[model samples]
Target: MMSETNPYMMVGERLCMDFINTVSWRESADKRREWFTSYAKWVDWCIHAEVLTGQQAKALLLEAEEKPSEAGDVLKQAIEMREVMYRIFKSISKDISPHQPDLELFNASVSHFYQTLQIIHEKDHYTLKFKQTENNLGIMLPPILQSAVDLLISNNDLERVKQCEGDPCGWLFFDTSRNRSRRWCSMSDCGNRAKARRFYQKEK
Candidate 1:
């Protein structure tokens, strides 16, 4: 069963956007909630994010059972990387330059994960892949980082990255609309709340 604490909202169209949005009600210190409380929860999120398959998750869980400390370390690393990504993208959405320290940290991770880069030969052609080590439970993180890196360098597409207009929502998304007018993360959730608030103000 999925955890009730996290609704697993996939409102962010891009994988990196969705990964950065794991937290709920981000700006309200009283209501803010973190989704990846433990290694298992992190793995579950990766599964829903399609960053890991069932078989891969199963193996990682088994390994985590044996190396709890290592698993915890991975969780910490994942959250840290996610926060760095959030800050970088949040600045982009607001038309400001991301902090230099954040960019350096992001590049550090990119350099670290790039070590696992390998070329695999397929029937028709070759493909680049991140090799998974049997003992590394954080294997699912590389692709997520790669997604952010791709977007950061996407030039014109970076303009489509936006934060929800909903107050304190703190959710980021990629606007794929032809006219790039998307504001809320989801029309059914934050969007409806905004509409209701506007209506109430009009009546009052």
Candidate 2:
């Protein structure tokens, strides 16, 4: 379910899906609504940050609407955006190792993302499988899936990587604010929304 109060969070969650089936041309109106709602937030994040121009965002949205099979290509663009975020993470670190200082955490995060990719590839969306085996201490999840879960737990900031707060959004960005007060993946949308929400709440 998508919540207006936390649009960015919704986008984060949906990114794991290879194709946003809800918003694709083949989906129902309800699914389209859900997809657009989350996608709007994502586009807003990129546009506000200038990572993507208004025209680009609009075109992407149009593409999403017209070509359901192109969802994978759209996701690929998102992955490229994420790479920029990884670079930012590297820049901020003082560690000199060829591998990230937080290599274990990075591996975990990557593994989690990889597992999500596998799920997308295998199932075309999100699906969970649980199996119990005899002679086992207890139930066991697949190792790749476990690694993915562990990665998310290990890398706290993976969630904080944001999109801009602007109308037409661009790429994924990291929030390195001292107070972690960043709103937009780049501040256009996040900041504006924060201000507007505060004003509306105060009026009520």
Worst ten in a row by lDDT for model 2: 135-144
* Candidate 1 lDDT, 5-74, residue by residue in tens: 5458888899999999999888778889999999999999888888988898998999999999999999
User: Which parts of model 2 have CA positions greater than 4 angstroms off?
Assistant: 1-40, 80-92, 98-204
Model 1, residue 161: C-alpha shift (Å) = 0.5
For model 1, the stretches where C-alpha displacement exceeds 4 angstroms are 1-7
Worst lDDT run of 10 residues, candidate 1, spans: 1-10
- Output the TM-score of candidate 2: 0.27
Q: Could you tell me the lDDT of residue 19 within candidate 1?
A: 94
Candidate-wise lDDT, in order: 0.92, 0.41
